[model samples]
Target: MDEETTEEIMYMTVLGCELAKPNPLRPGVNRSPSYFETLKQCCHLPIMQKEGFYRFLQLYNDSQVVVVDPESSADSIQLTKRVMYLELFKDLQVLCTQPDNVATRELGQRVAAELDVTYGEQVGVQYRKYNKTSDKTRLRFVTEGMLLQLIGDNPTMAGYSCLVLDFYEPTSNVDRLLPLLKKAIGLRCDIQVVILSTKYFEKFALYFDVPHGLTIGGTSFPVGVQHVTKVVADYCETACHTVNQIHQNESPGDILVFLATDIHVDRVVAKLRGAIPDMETFPLYGKLSKAEKAKALRSGDKSRCVITTNFAESSITVEGIVYVVGFNSIGTFNFLDPAKEEVYLRGIKDVNAMNLIDEVGIITPAGKVAATLPIDLTWYNAFNEAIKLGCLSELIDIAALASVKNPIFLRPHKTQHAADSPHGQFTAPLSDHMTELNTLHAYLRTKRNMSTQELATWCNETFLSSEALEEALVLQEDLIEWCKARLGVSEISVLTPDDKDYDVKIRKAITKGFFLHAAIRDDSDQPDQYRTLKEGSHVWIHPNSALGGGDWEWVVYHKIEPTGFQYMDRCTVIEPMWLLENDYFYPLPLTKDYGGKFWLKPLRAIIDAIDSSVPHRIGG
Candidate 1:
């Protein structure tokens, strides 16, 4: 054949083969070997827990059992046992607490999803609002609260053969459950208990009388650690600058930045967006919506940056993260102290406690007032605050469903019938903050006329979580039903913002709970300054609060920010007279009792003093 004819015949024979021609190699497109991508499996050498495992194994008839792994490597040790002895122990219940020491609701779901990949239906998750476990499930992950509820319902824990506490932190729920678990062990001699932690394993082992424990070395990859020689005043700016440098000069990988607070996270995210316009930025925090959190974890075409609080250090692990910027100093915030002028800042760890109060005040039936907590004053204060905020009653009611007796009277009461206090026909008086959230939930659930998309849009606009609101409504329904069944109250009412006396009632309720958290506006030295009612230290209202720039005489705050300076969070405006009404609990400044004491002036007298101290403006 002719050459042109031959070429034409070849093209006709391979018509679609033109698409298969090797394209020119684009320059600078092939990525370098990624450090994280080239990483093999997690690099922790498995250290066997023989003594602990054998003890757990022989404890088939002994309920009080303890297994400790000082390195917090007990996760793998316990899982191996579950896999090896799946026949003997039909199901193993693992309880996990987040790094921030709160009973996390998402950890169980995350762990369960990872486990299901290998174990399929054998692994399940249990939460307050949802449960994925069934009779066929052999491995279950539950939140700290769920385990307590389980103990309340099934004291013997008849369904599970073993219980393990992972990343154990001395939270109120965990501390409360330990003694109860000991009691349960005394009643039923079948289930085994294992406590795991990196810092508290030895202490817990001593507490549980487990003399033999294992210390598995922590798993870690080859990481190059660097430290700043000099401290930077503005951490957010430094963090954003470092992230931008990495994004511009480094290969494709995600960057994780650890910040002190949600405010810092938002700030860094905003700054990074402006600097690295092509990189995707996401913020992760406890209060962020689920969709927002999911954005941080989602795989995207563009390189991503995830800025989060210290909660991400242990609770979450984002994939493809090659660079990590961490801030060492954590902000410390103190909650309401039952005693005046005293604040408990740190958890008791041997001699590491700060602002330690050896003696705590509590109201006893015999009118006695001083005692110490079994765990620590910090947990005790948390319990006290919970009781005042009506959380104890809710937990008690929820526990009652499991035939568990009320656990309120176990703690010394600071106020008479704190759990039994009736506020507006309701048995339990929720804190003003919680009350507002509940009221909003109720309004959106029943009163609002909106479709699903509209509701979601409204939630996003207000920076609220639709899922959380729905969960709150379900929880409210459950509580109301329980109140009707147990308390025998014929009338039940849901307070809303539209209520005629909602503001008055809410403020009063807040005073009753947070009387010690009262702050007075004394702008003598600064334009807007607040001081604690007891200590008289200068405090500033959080910038996000509604009363931030306002000039209110007196206000009640629910929480203090965990920063160097004391910033009042969730502030609620209250009348000065309300502080006088709660004088029985905490002594508000009284002019009659003040004998030349500067900080002990009456509320009215203090307001007058503040007014006089302010410089008079001659002209507007």
Candidate 2:
């Protein structure tokens, strides 16, 4: 037998410090604020950011489609402010792809403060459970989902002259949005789109039919980079020791420590506080309330160490940051289960990897591949699957019910062909997640008759995200009201925990969306492994799931994580009879019972036979 081996090539760049240059602009000159000018005045840009700023300004002024790859959060924020200051567009809507509520709010408030206009009066922030935009508003920051809802309401996107996609992450929403944007650009000549990304710049330009693109490169103050030759045992301890070393040896300046999660941040904050009692230490993460985040961002007289998650890296800008300590937790993109976006971290070897200068240092991985990587084909199929599973159908129905003007592009269309390539299969169905959320919210609000305070308390006690729960409750209310007004339906039916058949009803409702994602327990495996009904893919229940320890014969999963062994997320136990009840859509005609080993065979055959070209009913 012969085996094949591949060679590993590593690319690394160590930045060295450079002298600062004096400001070139004359005082009080009558000059318009270009992206380049505004950013330079605010803060120092590394070599790459300055080059990207120049190229972006050139392409934007020419009205040529441009996509910018920003190296830091400061770069994007400064560029956005510069554009708003220019006042070239009538209305600018900035879409945020990440769920960093604090960062998004900070961006809006900062821009509003500089312009001397009140927040929510001239500057708007819109996301789940929060909407502040009005007719008087000129600049708005919104989540990508909110923008989708906006497009559904007004297909032409009337009155919006510029759309700025703040970050570039591979998401199904972005894939669904580009075509709609392309159509909108075609319909109106005044509309323009600015994409700010750290990756995938070229693919975006190619998709939008832009021939030329820009890469940021110029001379600026270099960052002192250091690499560890040996691996350390514990990252938190290593980070604390590094911070102590920097505080003692380095100059008087703020330090930034990057950890992976809130728990890690808390641990590091506690250790650093005890280690250096004189130095102020603060923790920052997405889950922190607005007040907490503000405190972390606030600059104090005491030399401080800001410990935070990776959210701070790309979405936030902390002032007076001269030293940085981070782990090698870089995301390696995988096509099959792209939603598992987080990567694990390792220690920074045995040495104290700290920059001993005034400039912030980065201990990044070896380096990134520079060539433009091809967009995976799975993204397109995943979007199509979302539409087929009625994820977008409800949004369209709501738009039509609320009297949206021509909700075009994505109608309630079903799959044209049944048997897609195995590689194209979606690990998570969007519709299933939606149904699960709706069911949970109804149980909490409608059946339990819980007040807002009670729901908050319940969420806290259950270790669930209150923000997510609140957003779901808001969506439920809007959905019910829309149905009542348009279809004259007084009330919609929902099952709660108090109901007699609550488990059966909720399980069936959620399982219906996962008709293609059903799995049966394998007798050969002890507890964790199960085989998918359609593809027989071996999977395990995610360790954090409530059903992980249960001996359920059948289950329906909403998502999968491909970590050597596939792990199911957001899983629920369901009866096999429930799938059989909906035989028309999910047939189980062939079954074998031999020596207590039941066989549910060839679900793909039935799935292929079903004619999905015709639009199906979305909800009861």
Candidate 3:
């Protein structure tokens, strides 16, 4: 893989190839060796995981030196892998994020196909279960976060001579690992990194202080934007109504309806069927089967609708999309209510966090009051319970799953509950977090002997995303890996099977973590909405959440998402006195009395204490 391997072709005499009528080379024509055929065998090297495994291929660029003869040109060459997919790349490894990211895929595919000079190989893309690469592949395209794992494992990124961060976007993961990448680059000057993006970020200059940069204009056609005059209360029904109107009034072409989640996709599709029976509709997301994605991508239909999330906006391109119904009603916006939220979210300095917003204060939406935060409290309680129950690893896995937006199970359409019936086995009566734990435990046990194809089939049968399951497994593995590296645990024991108090311990953990984010079910209002303890904010559990269906009286959450309804997603049912009786949170009653209303407000002090310490993050 080193540049010194290949000797420069200084003066090569003509070496004509035998042909029927004419010799391939002229009398003075100079020719160099083609080592690409030999390079093909080493392409299968698992460069991401192993060390000192280099796949050398000088066929990428044959003519590096300024040859004396114009005829003596150097040989030229040119990739794939999903970061979580656990695939291998030959030479250069690219880390990308979007599963259906069209721009990055297009570039990778184009580069693969355009490398006419690279002997014995072409380019390919690796994401989810889709593997378009082979042993002959040189340029392997993977995701950025996955690339971080590879970097974390091998800080120097020694296997590959080059790294390309395609469609590079700013992220907390990138921010954390960029220093390691820069140090790697500095150590290995021969290692070339090409960062590609649609828009340039000047902030990147802080790490990559390059004087000249390349810019490429986008080749996409203009898309007309149409905004709604009045936002409808029922977005799905309104979206269905809009699609119907567009089909009836506007030009006849494919319509892309953007919804918040997969459930909304199914909901809108059902409404569309009733509104316009003739239209063929398909739900598009990362978790859907190939058949579904193909149906959505297929054109030539006079009129069709693909209900999807914002994934369609930049990731994949659906042909014949003449109209788009933009609706993000289910999507949550910001979560930083207190400076501590930013401190956790952005990994910001606690001192700087206070300056980012005004003085810390709680402004309740409704006059109603309660005891905890729906999401935070639940997680805290669960973590604490797990600790007491001796199931921290299991809790970490559950927490990691909850921390990500990806779903382990699919939410079937409103009319297709039968499809989602398999998830019933994993469902816990009171808490969705417990249900997720049940599912994870089952998956981990099943994964021991299951093949990828079988796993995918099992997921489909269970109304789950094999893609999401794959990502969840990655997250679970990361948590486990971090535990070993940070917490220094080789194997964490599971909760005792005979321990009856294990469940109680889990509940105690919830109360422990979320003394402040606790709440009581607002019986006067909706059962789904709750009045928070410290802040009087009336927040509803997100419909996509597993706990949403359960009517829990006292609930706790980690954070509240500031969206249409200010949803508390990761909620767990809690006992009211769990806050006051708890020693750590016992001082909450003395903090301040709000008209005799019992609630926790110890966040101001707890956050201040944590302000001096850096947040604990799973490296890589």
> Model-by-model lDDT, in order?
0.52, 0.54, 0.53
| lDDT, model 3, position 445 | 73
> Which candidate number would show the highest lDDT if scored against the true structure?
2
Q: Model 3 residue 460 lDDT?
A: 71
Once superposed on the true structure, which residue ranges of model 2 sit more than 4 Å away at CA?
A: 1-56, 88-103, 211-221, 225-310, 318-465, 481-490, 495-499, 522-531, 561-567, 584-620
Candidate ordering by TM-score (highest first): 1, 3, 2
**How well does candidate 1 score on lDDT at residue 254?**
88
**Model 1 misplacement above 4 A:** 1-123, 153-156, 182-189, 199-220, 231-234, 241-253, 299-303, 332-454, 478-488, 494-500, 525-528, 583-596, 599-620
lDDT of 1 by residue, 1-620 (tens): 66545444433332222122221111233322331232113223333233333333343223256555643333443343342233332334433333331224454444333332223244556655466666556556666667777787788877666676664446656676778888877777766666666546676766677766655544434567788789898988889988888888877788999988776787788778777889999887666545557788897999988998755644655767788998774552211113233223312211121122232423332121112221112222322333444443332222222121111111111222342222222112323354344434443563368877776665444444445445454455555554455344444433544667654554565555556677887747564477777567778876544455567778877657766467886576777656544323222243232465555334557446435543241111
Colliding residue pairs in candidate 2: none
RMSD of each: 17.0, 17.3, 12.6
Candidate 3 lDDT over 500-534, as tens digits, reads 86656665665565566677665455758777765
Q: Quote the lDDT for 69 in model 1.
A: 60
Candidate 3: count of backbone clashes, pairs at least 3 residues apart or interchain: 42
